[model samples]
Target chain A: MNKKIGKHTVRLESKPRIISVTSVVGPKEGEGNLKDYFDIILRDDLNGKESFEKAESDMMYTAVLESIKKARLTEEQIDFLLAGDLLNQLTSSSFAARGMNIPFLGLYGACSTMTESLGVAAMIMDGGFANYVVAATSSHFAAAERQFRYPLEFGNQRPPTAQWTVTGAGAMVLGKEGNYPYITHVTIGKVKDYGINDPNNMGAAMAPAAVSTIYQHFNDTKRTPNYYDLIVTGDLGKYGKEITEKLLKEYGYNIRENYIDCGEEIFDCETQGTNAGGSGCGCSAVVYTGYIYKNMLSGKFKRVLLISTGALLSTTSSLQGESIPGIAHAVSIEYGKIGEKK
Target chain B: MNKKIGKHTVRLESKPRIISVTSVVGPKEGEGNLKDYFDIILRDDLNGKESFEKAESDMMYTAVLESIKKARLTEEQIDFLLAGDLLNQLTSSSFAARGMNIPFLGLYGACSTMTESLGVAAMIMDGGFANYVVAATSSHFAAAERQFRYPLEFGNQRPPTAQWTVTGAGAMVLGKEGNYPYITHVTIGKVKDYGINDPNNMGAAMAPAAVSTIYQHFNDTKRTPNYYDLIVTGDLGKYGKEITEKLLKEYGYNIRENYIDCGEEIFDCETQGTNAGGSGCGCSAVVYTGYIYKNMLSGKFKRVLLISTGALLSTTSSLQGESIPGIAHAVSIEYGKIGEKK
Candidate 1:
């Protein structure tokens, strides 16, 4: 296969800008300490049977509501809702939107939903289909655990390479051509299956997918890592980040100096013991919306490339003995002033 | 509410287009019989467990592929996939797109996915975000019955007011300002929960919501029902259509004289024992894509307003004894001569 960058003559662009971010991440319910391996929040005033589900729903609701509220758009003013989460029926995103009562567009790309959604949203904004659109995603540690792992009461040991699912929600409001950080470009990933097996070892499963798209992004624009103040990959834990670094070196491209993986930066690896690092759609979301976005808005960083990566394998597929195929999408947000009005 | 028709404000538009339809329905599989209640081609090679689900997945896959084939656009030539379905979690839509490798936008509006999708797709096309955009939706009888009603083997008797879930799929492609019928207008509905209880009586529950939007659409555009060749509403069976007619008459508007409800037109009430009519996302989908579009392309109908209606309630909500809130969105499409090139 040809490995040339920008070899494809097709391109898609977006004109609108993302103005702000608002996030929500609360401590796990019933767990006395906030020092748990995951910094996830629960919605329950107290723990009970449906606490986990409620938490997932509430966290997503709070995150998006806060983002919209902060953007100064009332619920009725929003033109559309773009959201997704890691739930069987997408219960969390749908239930939250149901309460919100805003016309919605539900999406599913696992962890990659944020950029996938943002890409479409930015295009819509640029095309003048909408003025203000909101994109959001959520993940809950307990809910995901019960669904994919063991029951809450089950005392089980996770693999050393297992990554902790982030308990958080992240949201951003993309508005009409504005002065805020305008989204410069978007690049979607192709599924790349490398025969990785352990569900817990998501970093290894998704890292290659991340590297391929990031490399493609750089190649497409003929830009180097230094062009961006920060090059962030969503939820690639310790091992995955190490592998990504090695891959970049092999390609004679070095982003290691400013490269940041949402997983590794979100939690204290040693204290929190998130062996690989924080994972799930929420990891990159909370980190970007909570940490990176605040800094970007404050001028700490002028330009950032957010690559949300995901392993598209489901539990049943994994159980049926299939290797996980991964994907990632890159979205560039630049803090520089937007171009003059049309 | 003050009702005003903006008749002079309505500017008639036209865009010439071509689309292909593929329908899959019923018991015999791989090669079987056309369903009595629906027009999908069937095959006996596929078993019971495989028919509906596979039909759904296959029909949706073929719908897009065929539509794209007819449109003279390759998969890569399409910029985005705007799709939806009547399934738990929208699994059918997502799963089908997974193999196609196109950037996708998934949606759920119960029986109205196709129309809602058209509204969104047209917006994207009109906004220039995409040169070629596709919107498709599906529903499987066995699959829906298992999820929304009793299992197939349960042998539960359905009420006369009950509607059959059509096992079919529909798809369409839109281009930038083409010779085809230009999508002229879109009116999104505000969900109305007027405290209707019976889940089985969906027609009665959804009628008011449908009527409200239809009325609003005419008022917003300042056009009367007589302005279009056809005024179509999705999945409003006999009961719902009657209710809609009554409500419209109360407002001094008579739509029954020229209106056709998808549910009633697709399935025979006496034979199928579907008192009101056929329902499900697939019902309106096959009816519009197969029957309506074919007629429009042949010049039988020039202007049409597809007001696809939906009941936004879920089993959980119904279980919790909450009243079903319904909503509807209308999109106007017109067919005229293809312009000569400059």
Candidate 2:
């Protein structure tokens, strides 16, 4: 039998200890809409240099604030801020954080930032760095399109495998000795070139990296597919997920029984038709923080392994004919006791 | 007696446990000029959209790669990527990593990203999550200028207290049982408002958060200012440093003797003439990875405390006339040997 050493402390039972997800926030409705490169329509009221800047910043801030609220933490009580966004100078995150001024550490891992940030945050708390830590990320279609593709109103058509950039943010707060399942293990992906030369086909490029990291994660911890209630990848589209499954099978692991890809799962709308699926920092973020966290809170699943995969390539390098490489990081987040007051 | 365990390990006789930084990489000798945002000089060679996108992506990739090289780690060996950047979709980091194909976790902390990433990475190694981890961040001038200040060609003048946006990247690698330092304690800053209302004066506004975190760090660790070689804050500029000093004195700790603020110290160049100093996410990153890390490797500093501060205000709130609040997170990095290498 398990025992409580203190108010929030948990003494492990005969079963292995599990980390829990206490709260999650972001995404107001079903799989958010994806804005095309030139499809972002901003009102004149929100126009100008500072306008869009603030919008992006505000989105990130709200995500984190909402998550903290769900966790019942004030800015003062939160131990750390782990946040990032898809902006050139990280203006949204930096600026959003400007007023909430709390102890913070910024990070960037592209589309996989949320899980990366959460992984590290959990480790810190588990290692006794602090009690509460928050992780957040944001992505705006206007800002991202302007940087990576055609600006708004440019009328560009995306490729078949191209993913809809998510214009949103997501956040979660983690604490040590909480009733939530503790973060168990993390797996870091390695940069690998499998000769997929197209930067646009990021899904295909990143699939293998995802497989390798996930495989290694299981290997390192001696865990099997049955160990987790759910296994999810960050934002690998349908194609990537398909290939990832095949690759995992090659390593003698079958994940289809309990696997879900955040990208494919979150943007599972017909008219929404997010090509391969939602692909952005916010894709996995919103899915996990909003949808997944809500489910966990309701006891839909108890143990989960979130592997956020990312394609780490640049347009310049793609233009330079460099083959795209990919990486992914895996973190285990679980739910603990049910209906606990915040 | 002292003995060498292997190429990866070092031991000392009854010496205090210390964590040392081995190397760093980023914009050590240059600055990004926001004024050039509208020059359109590179327009002929590349479209505006593509140019900015490439700039954002390249900067992110450059910082991570360079930091890894500086740390002398190969792409295959790194346990994980702990990174964050400001972008709408986290495109730069995702795209960059897609090409590198390294296992990674994306993170965000606005401008405080690097330190946050590092803090988590360090803790993971300390907690036996992984042996090696990398933390990185990047920012670009043109893209940021357009997003945060003005359109590319607006040519708006920045305030004197405003810091120059860094158009570069920074990266660092942490390893357990390496010759470098073991990250000790970490203190997360809280959002506190002394009611500084000016957006232009972010340096001053964020100073209090920095002071609070640093003071708390010393208190938690029960260490005095004279305990180590240096105490560094991530991006507090000249103005912020002065304020931090005053606040520290009130707490009865004198850090002025060995205190170093990354923003002020890094952009202290006469030519740079950065009024207060660097404020972008890359500021503290480049300083820590480049200047501080090199100094530590050369034995110039034995122990250091790196406090990365951030103002958690969105551009919208600032435009809405909301007061800016700030927070800070600190990681104690010490050099030398601790116990035995695994």
Candidate 3:
């Protein structure tokens, strides 16, 4: 009856299935490498809304509704909506939930929200609390910039280590019964601070926590790098990816062959002038829901270890000279495997 | 097997028990009506810390440690720590979690986070996901004031409707095996917006949400307002409480006699000079954990419904001329009844 597997990992007895997924991106992201993977691409960031904040909420709404529709279920069927975003007070997700009319639980794992919500959703489903749950997250470049950095109109100079915040939203429907990829395990993370205080270089700041969770996941599940066809990290950009790889090697695990950072994979940093790469709640969200989920459905990858890393630092905290505390949650998904019925 | 009852309520089959509770507050809250109920009261807001933010984190850390110690459980025995605060990025909770080293999930529902975390903790415990879970939330007046309004040194004039943010933290330990008040039901709320744009009048902004969740809880459980010994709202203050009562009366259910708002109960507005009342994540948290939990344990009250209301608005959102969205989550706790053995 014990679902917990070792220190921080959980092995669900009834693995929850991902029934449907949807991704929406702004024009800049749409023009990126995974353009074909996105469901809807807005021509502009505002999407005809008066403000970027409203546009972000609309993107989340569209993603949630589209995901539900794809799952062949009505809004009434969803037992809970678990969501969060980078905006203060989770404005985007909360506003989007107002129109959905579902029971809601607002979470804040920063950019790791996608995996955090997915882990909680699977736990609730496996625990027999709900038959269906929707997990979603969103981010807007302008919205995040004004809150976390400078205002959009500030035109502040970006450092080479600074990463671009992706303007997008992603939603996934998890249910008790489905023929989709099954969420087998979840490793909740501990808040780890390495004293990296640079807000612009979030990749370096979050890398340590990503390595911590990755090592814990492998230790708890007793699975080596080969156990997963793809080991993906959420938004650790090029700089953080290198740090993670180096740290993992020191921990006696080499994930060099299979590991890839979602931020680095989302855009061609050289040609796009994105500095380090992409970073935000939507960075890994769109990548996972769009590219990874589709690939799993096509049987291109059988097993995946998806770890979304988040740098938990606010503009106020950074200004106060506090170091960034990072967290990374790992969710193991396997394709072509059906979990036992409740 | 379906734990969900009606539209938004879930009836916990196992009925997770609250093992222990702890509350730590600032001098202002310690001088309030429920002064004697708090476990620890600081002499000042900063608690010897250089910054109010660090002081809030310290309070949270103390509360979490005290709650775990009171439960007679080691840190390793605790499966998860679910927590949040009013600070941007949940810095207080995240910093507190770092010291505890427990698997952490940072939640944000504005001031409603106490009930939000508690509900999720109970569900996880009842669903057999974990034997022990800790739910905690904190808020600091100085921290919230500078972030949401004027800086502490600004000496700005306050509005009559503005409620003082409580500087405190409260934590509760929930376990599968405990002879304490059992969580019977939880009603998750939907975000409701009625175009109330003023952040100072949060009570007016959040009242409808409190009404919505309370109504749904009564409807789902098929119970009247008088079914319980008491019904308390999180931080609706005087204005929101009146609005909620009027709204409930229009729905053909009157809760005037049995209802009390934690904000209203915490500080006497006339004597304490808290314009509307005390309002923050810690308002309901300390009140519930310190006074209500103790009373329930002594059998002073058999059944109670605690609804925590929150105005989910950020400084940026308000500056952008957006209306505040409100949310409220209700948790029904009952004593003198033993649940099934683990």
Candidate 4:
């Protein structure tokens, strides 16, 4: 039985294992801090595709296949593919699913899709819906720029608080039986809006949501900041990470000692000219699949809480002067001894 | 346990019950064929909101609240809210979730969102992840028009194959315990594309997917068309309905006698000048909640197969000359005796 924790949290009786993970990144991200951890790095953002959109779909496709291959599982062994991207209609995920031929559930949580997919995949596996499932997400700078902001050709000047959308894709193969780093708990989030309307300052806009979810996760699980080796947030970037920490403090939790943001960790904002940091569905995606998962396997991080945050706003909504609504989902993964039972 | 039967189908042992459902539509849909079945009908599309987008959000808000009220459950009793819309960033669902303060998982399946959400919500309930979950989706004429096609100000001449987007919102509350109309099976879909690129003819684009899912559902469950009193396709409209029948015939399963489309049933295309028919997330949403669900309660239909189809194409992809990929999900609902067990 899946145990229901305090509120908004589910503690699985049979934890789902992260059997295999893979990350693919463009040249910019390849040159970032976690370059060595990425599986494949493209020479350019387009990755030889004619369009950025195609490149994004192709990247997700490659990541899914690569993750399955790394898991030593054939395509037929994977029962479902849950994926999403930062595109209208989730074109990247749908187009990618066209080739894979797996049953697909297209999700849209903007940047938080990584954790959202993971949580759903975990639940599906824990509930015995499937033996194995793949969760993947991707985002591209050019594709996101044209869709959410000015087109690449426009050469519009970005504000200081603006974070560059990462050109990357990440995929994880989750299964009922595997080694360490099992997903133990999941906390789905409620949307929170604090009247922030600036599209460029997404980190600040999404900070409150990250804070809200993290607080809830702690409250639901009766755990504190010291419970995990690290508490990582997805794509809150530098400013948003600071805001989240401040808000968490206000909520009577001090996580600053063992906390980091994937957005800030992915790029050296000062040297990379990425202003605040990287912010996209792929930001936390690649970082987790590449750096975090590998470290967990090596026993460098015994336990971790991964929370991916998203700002739910469209170009039309932003243009119409609506405040950005943010959401975040948290998943707790712990290192277990091989063949150990919970 | 969730039993995997044929290729893409799952037989849920713990069938989730549809406790309550509500539909809200604009004046156009209110004046259509299923007008009497709707819970609330707005006199105007804007619903006194300043913009069509806000109106869309507000419509979803009202439908969700009305459904919860009809379910006789407080907001705190609902475990999760699974929602989606035809908007770019799922603005309506996310905005509504912000106000509802429920844990939300935003999905994007275009028109198929109605069944997609219900299927996931049922799985969540059956999986013991939650006791009660709400599934909701909305679409608006002006909102979808400006986002997908020409703005309302453009006044572009409509093509004969073009279907009018429905201006409506529908919400259903699914719980572990209820009286009747239990969801017994769910079929997740694979993305299928036959090189169709015309976004205006969405029904034609989505017909193949609907046929594929319905065929698989029959094969997996080992039941023919006679198993259900009604086999309904979400919003294939007139042209797509014909295509679906032809495709089903090719598959050697004749469903023409028992088949009806929510799109075609909701509107008199000839008199309403809705071209082929209605096609939007809300087309199937309002039709299911207002017409089919109400009729089922009255025992007009004892068993039904509801398959909602979606043409997965974004404005960016369509502009870039990518073919529209389509998907469909099927759910089996039966009129169970009160307190009956499987």
Candidate 5:
């Protein structure tokens, strides 16, 4: 009856099943390691839009529509659309919401928005407030590059610590009950900052928060690392992943055996020349909705934990000599009936 | 058991109560119409901070702490802190969350965040998921000026249609049971864009969406305008308030008698020179938490509907020749016992 477990985790009595999912990406993402996992790939980055910002919105719009279609439901049947993006004021999500015609609640969890949104939608269904809800998020490489750093037209050098912002979007329709992968628990995160200010090194900034949520999820759920088939962090990239592994170990949790970061898994960093790896709201979104969700449906993964990490820093904050605050939310989605354990 | 009503309204049978609320504002807002209602007024806009961004975060942080104190709850007792602001990447909120050490979920409904968050927290309590939750939002004039338009130091001329962003923050603690103003229903909105691109004319851009949600709320709940003692829109400003009045009449609902705009109520436009009026996440926030919430406690208002409206547009999107989108969410807060209707 009481959904609050321990401290921050919510144990959903009614596991909200993700009915259908869709992932859309730019051509560059289509050339990545898991290229075949995506549902739609744009012809180019611009996707015929006048600006990269519109293209980002169009990508999310396509994913939302395709996701609803994949669920075999019309727009009229859906109760709510919960979405957010990395863009300023969340233009991408709002623009996409315009066409959906569902009750919309825009969220902003930075890159961690994917899991944060899922957690909210899961609570809505588990609480028996809504029948069906769509949770989605997005980001664009050129858009982020321009908004966060230099303009795309202005060529600039990047540090190896920097991660490429994925030009993609992903959407999933979650229902009250179904035979699909069900979301069972959600551990909302705390904003943590270790005084890292460099925008180029977001992984370093976000890694602490990723570990904080992941640790709390385990502590509250009373589940060890072995309980999950895989524990995936949002976008900690390569360097942050290493930092997370070490920090998590100090907390007496050794997850290196089954741990993977979406940022690192999205691209073959060596061949793709993606510096550290992929990062953005789209990175974890596409990886989970595209790769992880597909694999779960195939029974390749029975129990999985997704921790979407975010660096809560604006250009203004960094310019004002403020540190990057980080946050990460973990949601548990499992397939096959759990026999009280894995 | 079904909490959702006919369309977008969520009928909270348990009626989560607002235990306590706090409002903090800058010097300019402190000199406005609702001056005496605010809990804390900063001596200066900077509030001894190095930048406007830090001051914004501090204002929200103060409101959060004070609200918790007023509720007689410690940071540890609060289950989740749901907050957002108009700043890019939601830095103000995330930074505030850093010190609280509570589970955090950042929202981005633009200015509508105040209601969007309350709706989420209400559902969480109604669902018996959490015992207590906090919903907060803030915005700063200097921060908005630099981020959305020209820097304050640049001294750019503003159009008469442009509304001044309010420099304030407000927070409220919601609990499952309490003897305070109870939240009864929530109507989530849809993003509506009528192809308005002028950033200076956000009132024009947001008015339709405010009316859209208001009409939907009344229709879904089968409640006439007379059901509410007061009906309020977030920050539609003087001009947008007129638009809403005209549009709602077309919907066959005459709410003009009791309808008031927070943007208009917060400032004496004639004396304050706040162009159209005060507008920001803080405009509706401080007005409601400081003035409206207090009135409800004193039984001056029996039933009130707060529709926090938001204009969803980023500078980049506008620069890209995109139109401004609007979204508004309505939350029903009432004092004393409701005998089915006011």
Candidate 6:
């Protein structure tokens, strides 16, 4: 008995529970601040694969299996797998699903895929359509660069505004109901374009979208930022996080104190040599499923608003002189049983 | 309330009604077998756009507005829009969704996008999470050719097994419940790769997926193919359709008498100079929304199973020596009333 709240938000009455989760990342991410949270840390980017693309898919496959095992369930018991990645035609997810034999639904929300997959998984569970399903997403540094920018052989210098693409994957096992963190609501975002065209400055392009969804979520849920312990944005690096904060303030919300961008949280920008911070589909996914999940389970956090932002653009669109459009989907995860806010 | 049937099928209790639909096609498709069924046919492929990609996006935008207007709905009244396209990062869908403020969920199922969108839309509506939502998909011939194969100006010779990409879009408005045709069941498919590596022979690559899903649907529902007035494979073309028929027969189900492939139905292959048939996200979309919708409204096709098959590979994946993985999603649309399958 879920209800559509206002325009973009849906109040999930069933509050599907997170059964288990797994995070797999490459060596670079293994050295990040949330390193201890990951379940699998590859020694190198290739992870025994011939190419980065294959490695990215294998990372997700590992996450899927690890998460199911963590939840004490077999592949046959899982009803569906909702996954996506920042690759052309969703090759990363497609290849990963091919070996699993689970019913698959391919999703594409650019980097906002983490929440996009989670939102769909939660809704399907809340709807009583399935007892169990998995929501997962992944991205690789080398794979994304080749697909979205110049080839690796070109050795072009990245602009200062550019954020490092996280080489990682995250998977979450969601059940109909459990004592784990409850996904109580989801706010789907619209494509918001501020006419930012530079592909290197995705944070700038996606900032407005992150703000818009967060603001809409606040209004629709009839709650302020203080209602939750934290309000996190996916891959909006330090600069983009600043923009989002200012934008939200203009909309009558001041979330400055309780906000943290996953891009900034994942890496120490200055020491790590990552121009801005970590950013990609995996940036928010690993942070949420690994760091956030662990914190929530340990009662270190109560309620959290996770808004995964994405820049909706392909190299072709950029070449065709189209401005980058951004979108963000927000999911409210509260620790406790159903009807328990804290 | 929905019931999970057997392994992969869902029996939707609400039976969300199809409120309205629209189909848009280009000049080439307009001259095809189902010419009269299209809602809007462009005089040329460009449709006044600067490029085929933009034209494809605009065509879908037209379908979105046309379907909404046909249902007497304003964009504001629409709760969500689920859309996808056979473009990188879903550029066509993302751009089309940008102009509309409706909250969007981007899907990527290659050619299977049409049914993927419909299945999610139906579930959300049946769950009472959305009062009205739209499911849409699209593809463009020139755009696809340049992206997937050679440049349009390359003048590459087409192989006999090659299918022409369709220049079209299809959109449908789904509501909570009404007297319209009911969406009662959906069988989400797994990725099936039979190691078909030839990019030109997508029919062979996707046929196994089509058959696997259809056979699974029949088995899970405990019903034979005769229960439906028509059973359509999205765009498996002539050869794929034959393979699907032969494969289903081995599974103890015969659907030859009432079976048709959208790819085969969309164009007169021999006359149109299309080697295999029409195959793209738009192929099944236009065929279903244009041809099937008209026939159903005219008291034909009472019960139908629409399985949209997708070849889940990108040019990058192919170049990286990967085989084409395929997935098919099946949805059951029954006419007249909820309890009346006939």
TM-score, every prediction: 0.83, 0.69, 0.97, 0.98, 0.98, 0.99
lDDT of 2 by residue, B83-120 (tens): 66654434456566655745556655556666766765
Provide the global lDDT of candidate 5 against the true structure.
0.92
Model 3 earns a TM-score of 0.97
Which residue window of length 10 is worst by lDDT in model 1 chain B? B1-10
Candidate 3's docking class is high
Best-fitting candidate, measured by DockQ?
A: 5
- Docking class for candidate 1: incorrect
CAPRI-wise, candidate 6 is high
DockQ of each: 0.21, 0.23, 0.80, 0.78, 0.87, 0.85
In model 2, the Cα lDDT at residue A36 comes to 22
Error of 1 at A183 (Å): 1.4
Q: Over the stretch A251-300, how does candidate 3's per-residue lDDT look in tens digits? A: 99999999998898888888888889999999899999999999999989
Report lDDT (Cα) of residue A189, candidate 4.
Answer: 93
Clashes in model 4: which pairs? Answer: none
* Tens digit of per-residue lDDT, candidate 4, span B131-169: 889999999999999889999999999888898999999
Q: Model 5 segments beyond 4 Å from truth?
A: A338-341, B338-341
Q: Could you give candidate 4's per-residue lDDT for residues A5-112 as a string of tens digits?
A: 887999877889999999999999999999999999999888889899999999999999999999999988888899999988999999999998788898999999
| lDDT comparing candidate 6 with the true structure | 0.92
lDDT of 3: 0.91
Clashes of each: 20, 93, 0, 0, 0, 0
**Best-to-worst TM-score order:** 6, 5, 4, 3, 1, 2
User: By lDDT, highest first, what's the ranking?
Assistant: 6, 5, 3, 4, 1, 2
Candidate 2 reference-contact recovery: 0.43
Model 6 clash pairs are none
